[model samples]
Target: MNKRLVVLLGMSLVSSAAFAQSSVTLYGIIDDGLTWTSNQGGKSAVQMQGSISQGNRWGLKGAEDLGGGTSAIFRLENGFNVNTGTLSQGGRLFGRLAYVGLSNDHYGTFTLGRQGEAVGDYIGALSANGTLPGGILFPHPGDLDNNGIDFRLNNAVKYVSPTIAGLTGVAMYSFGGVPGDFNKNSAKSFALQYVGGSLQLVGAYTSIDHPATAVPEGVWTPNNTVNGNYGLAASSYKVLALAAAYTIGSARFTADWTHTQFGGLDPTLGAKINGHVTFNIAELVASYMVTPTLQLGAAYSYTQGNVSATGKSPHYNEVDASVDYLLSRATDVYASATYMRAGGGAVADLAPVLSPSSSQNQLALRLGIRKRF
Candidate 1:
């Protein structure tokens, strides 16, 4: 009887060990709010927006312990509109993040699938505009610099090093997935960051070999001029950014600078359709915690766009402020406002009004609540 009991106990231990090796979790956030925008085509409009302070998302992440300090992991996250109950990120089911990889405590992690670039990962941490408050309105024109743009690259591989002495590094690559011309859609990025005490610093760079083309106005025709065989080498987009932040007590300050360049388009297209453009952006932000549950934040941004082919130089200045009140650990409410003024050549002519042109102004206000579970 004693021998039989020992054998059964050993079997139970083995089964429990196996169960501990693998686990999965489900998590998500829902954010919906009302917003009012003035000068949305010369008229003020009120609309419901999702993910105002944070992008509404649901995700599944899992890990398997392989023993000896090594593990396998994967994540699939999707963005959606809390107001309309629709998929965001260009209608992709897993538009935010989808990847699988392995990790070790002493080593690092390597993942492959749709993922964010290195620059976006590092620079995004430096700005309240990137994290809360301003949202997409504070991004540089076209989000060319990705300082809070949250642009995701499809068919990509990423690597993140374990933190060493308060420092971490990342590298990423994207495959265009285009057949017959593999290099045309390829992109590469690198970033390094350091965090110690109250200080943080980050630097990053990225390059694209062949970027996807954008459709022209009122026309469904393919505008592959940027990547088509007839256009320039198609690999002409580049970006670099530096950012730093310091925290003292309940107050924090941040500063960031970024530069971006785009080139190589089909000459047959109009001036707005082709040629080279450069954008430079700088911003300063500050935030103070009134209490654990209440905080106030503000920011100012300046952006300049220079066009090589069109002789246009436009500039934009913006101011943003917000107050957030935490209702509970899982829920919060906030009100924010942004005012922007644009000046320079033909800025008034750009459609969608998200790009550089002459004489453009906008004002926006949002009040909403968010809950996470």
Candidate 2:
């Protein structure tokens, strides 16, 4: 070969080697199903739904080796409705999750952008709401605790600690980015997790200020006007939760508790807010592996809301069950149902997941299939 050709070939080899350090992947899941509601707007109906078993999504994720045992990473995930081919999460293309950050094997992971809070990440995984079979309707009323992945924060900074002696720690904050006020719509969250043998535990806290001002990101305002019975906005919102799980052979048991407080509020949809609101929710869930390809799950949740503003203390109780048969490692067929009863509460909304029922009781059922790629 000529001298010039030899030099060009040598450069190509070097460039190819450098490119090997960076990798990208395209991934996604599709869940489609049909749902039957015993009561919807005082009318029973059957509807086609997407993401019933799991949210439909597609994304690009990549990692670039930066040396020193640290790497730069990015993820862009989207949510959509497979039934109608429409975008979920208010038309945002990459609404499910989007983030970029650095990862260190010995240190931890830190990322920035729109993402899930610590409660749903560290604690939710141990509950039925985060599982394949029970996720559709497993959340407490209104998904108040986000155990079912109802919301994500915008302009967020998140950090996760490396596991040490069966323990891991997490911290995160989301800046509202308002010009004159840094706390206008800011949010803060923290969590600690422990895993030992067949037992797991998690504790988490999240607080938000002026939740209504950041509506576009799907952050649930105290009143939840986006899709709730009463549109109330709170100046402050906070949630504290604890969860635990234990495994015995093929069966797992989980229990969780959450307390939420809403301070100072304005009504955007319903009666004027005259006082504050507090929510206490408790849940128990169970899952079992009947066989290598079959799994069964069940859950029960009780949520009581003390609406001090109106002295209308309402309570909701729910039960859910599901079964999934794996067609393959990455695919499954599933069915589930949720039944709920309400008393001393006029609001019967299932916001962030489904619409409110016209009556005090509601039953929803679904049959679906899911595939991951």
Candidate 3:
């Protein structure tokens, strides 16, 4: 009996050691705010907004070591609204991210499921609107170029290369999942990034077929557009963007440019135009760390638009300013102000705000708190 007891105790120790090779974690963020708009459908108003600085979310992630410098990894992330307790991203349980993949030290990581495009992964890091201190209000008009990741791709297969000499590359493809048509609603994206010392650079490109059909709940949807009543129904959508950031002392500066196109529009399908439309946007951002727990940021952007069929051109200009104070490592308070002006008969609009201004100018102010765990 004594010998058998010793063997069983040894087996239990080995089992526990093996189990330590796998691990899982839960994490989330909650952000809520109050916003005052100078013009929302011709009236100045104040409202409660949730997830202004960061989207409210909870996520589970795990990894299992498989030996030989490889591991199996998975993540499931869900987005929700703090104000209404409703799910975000079209109400999908794990709409923000749902993926499983394998990571190898020597090779690269490969993943499959619904995921973000290369633009959001690579170039987004260097864009002001992609991160805190700038927040959602800093994005270009309509978020048309996806600098802040307005939508994600479904049925995607993604590859991320291991960093080599401070450079990394990423690619992704999303299948349309339409039984007979392979290209319909499909998407392809690529990105390259380099980070070294105080300077960072990135470039990304993405093309999607049938924007409205590919992402029904995304930016092209009627309710998702800047103005709730309008939608863009195009045969294809494309974006190309480049960005660079430099840090000096307690200050950082970023500059980025993006080009977006909506091609082959059908006027009968809720599209206002019979032909394509394109936009070119450029932005500059600067941020300064005033103290260990305080920061200030500002940005300016310009957008140019052209309609292929009407020979019409329009332009827009926007400015964003923000301040952040850290209450603790896991909590912070922030304030932001944004203003936009439109020219050439274009209406002033901002993303995530369902209404367009009655005039060609708009302004908004927000105060918010964010907590991460």
| Winning candidate number (lDDT) | 3
- How many clashes would you count in candidate 3? 0
The Cα local distance difference test for each model comes to 0.72, 0.80, 0.84
Residue-level lDDT for 43 in candidate 1: 62
Q: How far out, in Å, is residue 194 in model 2?
A: 1.2
Report the C-alpha lDDT of model 1 over 1-373, residue by residue, as the tens digit.
9999999999999989978889999999887788777756456677787776777899999999988888999999999987678888778899889999999898899899888876677786676556555565555444556655456777888899999999999988887666898776688899999999999999999887655432011111222121111222233678898999999999999998888776664444332346676778898989889999998999887788776666667677778899889999989898988777767632321112232222376677889888998
Q: Write the per-residue lDDT of candidate 3 for residues 275-320, one digit (tens) a residue.
A: 8878899988888989999999888899998877777677899999
Q: How accurate is candidate 1 locally (lDDT)?
A: 0.72
Which model scores highest in TM-score? 3
Candidate 2: global Cα-lDDT?
0.80
Name the TM-score of candidate 2: 0.92
| Candidate 2, 99-132: lDDT as tens digits | 9999998999999998888877766776667764
| Per-model TM-score versus the true fold | 0.88, 0.92, 0.95
Worst 10 residues of 2 by lDDT: 221-230
Per-residue lDDT, model 2, residue 310, is: 61
